[model samples]
Target: MSAHFKINKQASMLMWTLFMLMAPLSVYLMLKNKTTLIEWVLFNVSSSPIMMTIILDPAGTLFSSTVLMISANVLQFSTIYMKDDKFIDRFTVLVLMFVLSMNMLIFFPHLMILLLGWDGLGLVSFILVIYYQNPKSLAAGMITALTNRIGDVMLMLSIAWTLNQGQWNILYMWETSAFTWQSVAILLAALTKSAQMPFSSWLPAAMAAPTPVSALVYSSTLVTAGVFLLIRFYPFLSSTTWFNQTLLLIAVSTTTMAGLSAMTECDMKKIIALSTLSQLGMMMASMGLGMVNLAYFHMVTHALFKALLFICAGTLIHNHMHSQDLRWMGNITTQMPTTTSCFMLANMALCGAPFMSGFYSKDMIVESSVFYSNNLIMLTIILFTVSLTSFYTIRFSLATIWGPSNCSPFIKLQEETSLTTPMLALSLMSVISGSTLIWMMPMNQEPMTMSTTMKIMPMIMVMSGLIAAWYMNTRQIKHVPLLMLTPMMHYASCLMWFLVPLSSQFTMKVPMYISHNYLKSLDQSWLEILGGQGVMSSSFMASNSMMKTFNTKPVNYLMMSSILMLLVLATM
Candidate 1:
């Protein structure tokens, strides 16, 4: 017990020490020298005898470094933000675990180690989601946990498939020819982890957690794990035409559906959640097109801005005593100027405005989709997605920062120091992180410049969507018939539910009857199918047959007994 206690204490100290070291180390690496955090870590690992060196190509280095830098900053932010929270110790431990797992995941040379870190982070995220322990929050946490577990299973299957093909090594798996089944499994895992399409039902529900948990896990790390896996396994995915095609379809569908959902959402966190799903879709599409560097660039920028936005939203909610509905919020620009400013800056970044971090990375993705392989379908889908991206971004910005103040009368509010400090720091990062991406890691490829005509299209799309939103929302226009606008488009939103069926179909073809009526019988025979209907029934029948056979052998049993008695008398 004493030894165990000592080890626990040591682990706690090491966790804090690592965080303290990494935060300063990341800044120094990024600022003093232009070397990214991933390169530095990889260099050190390469030099170490015990730790196997994993050499990162430019794309891998870029992705890993960005994750490291953002994670470091968030960890620093958490120290201040979670200071006054009741479960500070537990929160810190999970935060440390998350950072450690992510870092190890990106850096590990072995596939097994990477999987360990991958699953560890997912588990920690689920725990953090339920940290609040409220009924609604717990329910949401369960959904998030279970959904992620499905992703985990898919990932494990991919790994097992790779191992079966004698590709146990991480690097070898990518280089091997046995990637088709592995890629399919990995893609399913990615779709679920990224909260794409039908699997996305858990994400909005996850908003029941505290805003910080949502910010870190949902917006940045946990959700983006899918994108990371895609990029990391890009070679395998790129090798398969079917994999790329499937990924592109899913990405486009997810982007369109999530953007529409974001538009309709009234809750601040839900908007962010839906926006997260949309952004992930964009990243996945980028990866599908073999634009790994661009995807990583966007992931980094998105993480910084999204984390800032969520923290700012949390500040607003915390000040308002947990009211997250945008309708109840108004004119807080003056009261919470720091948070409001942060929110606006982050929103602009999300919108992919010119010169912003999101703009550069997102434009690269769109341009890649347009130029790659002469596929007009990919281009059109991406173009439409870009428009919706801007539209929903504008909607989210307008709902949170624009319009009349509608503060509720009954709710008492106060700004806590613990919350505002993180919001202020994140706000500053949101503006400056774009410059870091542009200047620090200047792309070898020439930057794509948008023509006046090209620029006009996206702007027009944004404007039209905003106007439509205003028209639909206004009391005078609220009564306008839904048919006047795009009635077909509205109905298509319900088609998001088809994602569940589509993904299931990808795995197995469920009978129409089973798919339709399964819910009605979910409570009854669901366990039988899952547990062991065939095996249990067979076992019961075998036991009954054996009992009858034993009874029928009574004459043989009596004969054997008489023989034994005669043998015993002869011996006497």
Candidate 2:
């Protein structure tokens, strides 16, 4: 290893050690005391009313604990995954800043104070996404940054609006009649961070970053930041029924699109990214349903399993000489037993398989949606989404584990402690975190007794999804043609219902066009006319008038000067 790497590695380890130690203590403190602590008073701003209001609430502390847990393990995994890269130290530094920013966001109860961490997340994430310094990476970074900047602007506007609310701490605001509009802005900000529909293009593009960054981004940091914000804002949002309804609409649409596209995506990382998007939508929907704890529970549990899934995918891609295309891979179950086991387990948990970490939160979400719903259209969409989610999960496993092997001879995956240990840590959570978290943060005062139909619907959908995926992606079904056989259907599905083209590529051009117009008209023509050019033209006219008088006679010049002086004196 390079001499530089050791120093950077030690620094990274030290930083994560501090964060890891704090996470558990925060969770423990929250569980022990039903109250929250807001300390770390670093001078408050009089004008902006910003202060260091670091909250130690159950929701915030628990989410921060999850962030640090996943981040610490991802860092450990990166040491092995990125050991060969020359820029490993730079990656390590960006990751340190990345996790630090999320933690800052986690603890800050003041909206104004949290904006610092919000922008820090955007800046560090852009740098990380483009770390490779390649054309594709740069483009991806631009998309990710610009998309996230939407949330930043929304939050900024909310902060400005909150300035009029007398108190800067949103946690203390029990009544929000005057600031209902600002609350909408906060929800939209969370939507953008979580990459809900219309803003969903950025998450898949963010796979351009190193696998470790992707692992951290989708697992606990960037993608879940919105849900974390919404969870904290739950009390205030209860009054904003319109905002909740709008959020639910956007959330379900995002979930639907991600689910459909995931089943067709061949890129291993992109499928995972899409799945993360879908789950974020679920949490967002839960927020709309007024089940903030359920959303938080799902967010925490999903983080554990998803982080493990990404680590396994990263290792598989690395050992396969950095190919992320699932079509070019298969039957790794026989070759890399440990990674395959982790991958399958993670996927199963993602599908909310019985008693899994995902099942604990997800099944509750499903059952609650049915009991809590009257709109047949919304309920139908939710049920279909559950099935779609299951289908994608099964398809991911089959494509990478049971489908035809289409590559050259495989290289042995590293069986080192660094490589497998983190996955093992998370795999344990994937199996048990759901029940543990449900106990710690239950959905209701007592057990929620759901009807048989509500309970059986998810199982039926999951079973159908499994059967369909096996029918299509199964090695034994080699002779059976897939249902999405036509080129047009495949094209639509693979392009993510053409949302990327509409949202990321084409929608991005609108800003470019506006910027170009601003440069030409506002900066060039208008400013020049009013300021520099206007002064120069006036001076030139004056000079020409003086020269004309000089060419004529002294009397004419005297008369003109007298007339000009008289006009100026009259105006005054």
Candidate 3:
């Protein structure tokens, strides 16, 4: 038992060491304005060179470093979270494999070689999602796996389309007349993988996974893969105007949907998952506005705090005997001071509080986006979504960390090193990494001319969201449950505007119904009666009739036998 703990500790340390090494490399690459690509030519197909490629650009290195850092903290936290589980060692291996796949996705630029990591993420994520081995977990895993598979197919199609360009290396491919369907294909792939709009349901459903896995997968690896892909393919996809517009609509819808859903959510993990979804929308919106570097910056910064948020949430969940309902959690600050502080730090960052990591990245995204576009309605929706972010963040904080306790009177909570250590480590990053990365990375720092009103509008929106959420929370404290006040609105928001059913059950209903009817009419009835069973029954009746004839006429049978013997003797 002790050996397993040591193994996890060692693994976490090793990952942290790698993160330290990569972080400096990323900074150096960014400072030098150099991209290192090491390619091994394996073979050739006609004119195109088939090679294994590793790209060490600042973006790749920084993203990899972020992934490693978050994964290390998650692994350390998992040591406590899964301590009672008998297969902790097995869990560690799965996590390591998940990290490996994400690194592969990051460092490789070729579409063909990238599939190794792409498919690996989808496959491993499904395994992790269903790690608990229950019906709900299995269903969640299926939805996650199937939704990701859509992206996998689109990625494969993009690779095939790029084959015509004489190479699969996306780094060297310049936008030309030849770049058409591949851009759309890649966009679809990114959309599905990032859980945008119609594909958004699976993100919340995937909360069925263990908390450590959620921290790693949601914060840096699996969900962010789509955003990373677009950043890589932005040079090509940006030329298509329809792609940008389409993405803008999808991003706005997703952001609104996730924010509303989170406001109504009670489950602690799902709320965090929805918030992650909403953040992904912001990233996509940046991409839609042609701010790839800003999107990338947000992606890296978002990874830091979101991972911390999940770790803190996991600690609370672990101590609460795994009850994730926010209703049962309140006044946690008094019992676990260290954890509650870290939790609020993460939430502050998430809400884009001044000087927090989220403010450095998210504020820029909103400001730059509003400056870039002239569409008032779209901008309005995006601003509203930003407010929604703060709304849910405050609503969640009040319900769980600061609300009155609904648990047993004798419930006890304590901060363990295994839990607090990772939380503290991530909490530090959540505070500083955003500002640090924004300075270090050579992201587009274009000057924007905006009115004073425009400059503070995002902050204003955020404050309004906080006030509204506080009002709602106080009303809930005084009166009936939130569900009772507005049942229909709560229901729609909880279901993500019916997206859950539309994406999952609705999509499957028609096909599954058809299959069920086929089974009943063909396999069970017609095929059984007319195919195998009918043949057998007919043959059996014929044999029985012949047997009855033989039994009823023994003399005739003997005569026939004698005749047969005579004929056999004559032939011989």
Best by lDDT: 3
lDDT of 2: 0.82
Q: What lDDT is reached at residue 49 by model 2? A: 42
Better of 1 and 3 by lDDT: 3
Q: Which run of 10 residues does model 3 get worst, by summed lDDT?
A: 476-485
Flag regions of model 3 displaced more than 4 Å: 174-178, 476-486, 529-541, 551-572
Model 3 lDDT tens row, 220-335? 99999999999998877777768888888899889988988888889999999999999999999888887788889889889999999999899989988988999998898788
lDDT of each: 0.68, 0.82, 0.89
Give per-residue CA lDDT, model 2, range 1-572, as digits (tens).
Answer: 66656755575477567767776776576556454666555564665444567776667766776777777778778887888888777787788889889988988878877888899999999999998899999999999999999899999888777766666686777554557778878878988899988888889999999998889888888888888888778778777658777888898898998898888888999999999999998888877777777888888899999999999999888777888998888877766888888888898899989998999889888887787754677777877888888888888777778777778865664556776878898899899988887666624533557778667998899898888877776655454434367787777777777878898778768898999999999899889889989889987899798887576777777987899899999999
Q: Which candidate number maximizes TM-score?
A: 3
Candidate 2 residue pairs that clash: none
Between candidates 1 and 2, name the one with more favorable lDDT. Answer: 2
What's every prediction's RMSD, in angstroms?
8.3, 5.8, 3.6
